[model samples]
Target: MEVNRFESINEGTILLIDKPYGWTSFDVVGKLRSLIKKYTGDKSTKIGHAGTLDPLATGLLVICTGKATKRVVDLTADSKEYIAKIKLGETTPSFDLETKIDATYPFDHVNRELVETVLKTFTGSQMQEPPAFSAKYVNGKRAYEYARKGVDPKLEPVPIEIQSIELVGFDLPSLVIKILCSKGTYIRALARDIGKALNTGAHLVELRRTRSGVFSIEQALSIAEVEKKLSNMCNQS
Candidate 1:
């Protein structure tokens, strides 16, 4: 059945966007809002994203528009899947490449067997502390804001579930793994913990969200693609 763009958008629509690197989740929302306004001529259309992806990470970002905004909670609550590349022998305040290396350790003892064993320990429910440089609010300010000013915020460990972790590639100093975790799980923190388990330090180098609930990267559209689609819809209108 052919759907009318205005009617569909006004009612509700879930947009699966492939968020580009270096762009905050809010950037995607703002860009889409502009395109939507241009297309529908409605400036007050509701739009929001289900989850926030760090500027360093990229992949499927579930964006809900119009009445679909109500589904943001449900969408964010779903299991998330990610492929991460963690660099061992180094630690960073941000737990990822977003920050400079603060410390380093000998990773010579790390091997495939050790990696597998350490990953096993992270399976199931556990309390994990978020990175100091995270969006987590602290004292009415974002944690990252404190981190930027050379201040450490006291962040409590939150309970999270790790459904599974599979070693995709294992090379000395670099471990590529695929993870399926519950909402609120931080891959950067996981990387830091994994390094600790091995008696070494580690930090996330590359991370991508391959899936969120039923939405996969395969179903996501780039910002440009979305813009074009909206433009076409506007022309049709």
Candidate 2:
């Protein structure tokens, strides 16, 4: 694959990297910042990421450097696609495995047909309440900050658009779904809502961002690959 982006990395360019699981969005930015500085011999290079992916999530991450950092806002506003694994019959505090299970429910009644119907209810424009364990601000502090201390902040329901939802696989309490949604949609929250609609509890087990705007995971390189490119750049410099 020809990646012209890395060629102008020092000058300012967009870099698409596949973010690995267990790595925070900031961690990726920091690593890349160091790599670009070390390889291009430009410590002053500016770097930023368009959207933030949870540490538990893995997939495409759009990173920008130098003057390209200015485009982060526009990039973050783009719609995204994700493949998420949601588990029914159990609810967690963070709406994902990041926290302990808060409750459980009977999922004996949930079926593929019911799930397909429920997913349609979530399609199109709707107001979604974000997970309490989220980065959303409340009273000048992060909502997760309050959630960490066992306080539930007043998180507002934001308007979001779910372009499409496809039930890729479903067996018993576990489900695999493909979602195309607008910028503000939270898969965790969606999972919780789906549980409610089905009279059960649910939480996110795994999530992977597959696409953002025109960039797809297929076009992204891993951190190691990026490092190799940087090393080559250093040799050239």
Candidate 3:
């Protein structure tokens, strides 16, 4: 069922937001919390996001407010879809552009056919290691903390499913792909593995979450739009 935007603060509702790049998932929640408090004068209203998207990525973010926050676990369990661009011939410790390139390789041997075949190998359940610069907790500290200190935490691999991988576009060194995968699947890790398979190092240059479960970017509102709506609501009250 679609939620009514004009519902009372105590009435739960789900919000689909087009999270802007450079903004963390927690940043969205914080902004919305302030808006709700200003509009409804309810400082204690609960607001949470279903999943976490990296600050460097943009797109659909499922935000739950009021009683709807209770379903966050169920919402996060759904499959996710993403469109990413990987740059061949180079790799970074963080797997994405968040970190500087640590090494380079020759991409002369990489081609369209080779990429298609390599993607096929990843279209099933497999064990994947999360990136070192990730939110994964280790001994109560974030994995990135250990990575920043030059400590290799040696995170264990976990099972993940890649439902589908479609090659959207491919140039010699840059490849664009659309992926549908189960929860916990990391595109950064996939980029790294693809490079390894091609005998050329690679890393993610860009990434966007297009869908999460039943929510799609098409139905999501931008931060500015949400803020404007909340402002109007405040005036109406």
Q: Model 2 segments beyond 4 Å from truth?
A: 1-4
**Which candidate, 1 or 2, has the higher lDDT?**
2
lDDT of 1 by residue, 93-168 (tens): 8999888999989999888998998899999999999998999999999999998999989899999999999999
Error of 3 at 237 (Å): 3.6
Evaluate residue 166 in candidate 2 and report its C-alpha lDDT on the 0 to 100 scale.
Answer: 97
Question: What lDDT would candidate 1 get against the real structure?
Answer: 0.90
Clashing residue pairs in candidate 3 are: none
Residue pairs clashing, model 1: none
lDDT of 2: 0.91
- What TM value does model 2 have? 0.97
Q: Tens digit of lDDT per residue, candidate 3, span 1-237?
A: 584364654578999999999999999999988878877778898988998999999999999888899999999999999999999999999999999999999999988999999999999899999999999999999999999999987888999999999999998799999999999988999999999999999999999999999888898998788878887887776
TM-score of each: 0.95, 0.97, 0.97
Q: How many residue pairs clash in each candidate at the backbone level?
A: 0, 0, 0
Candidate number of the best lDDT: 2
Error of 1 at 162 (Å): 0.3
Give the clash total for candidate 3. Answer: 0
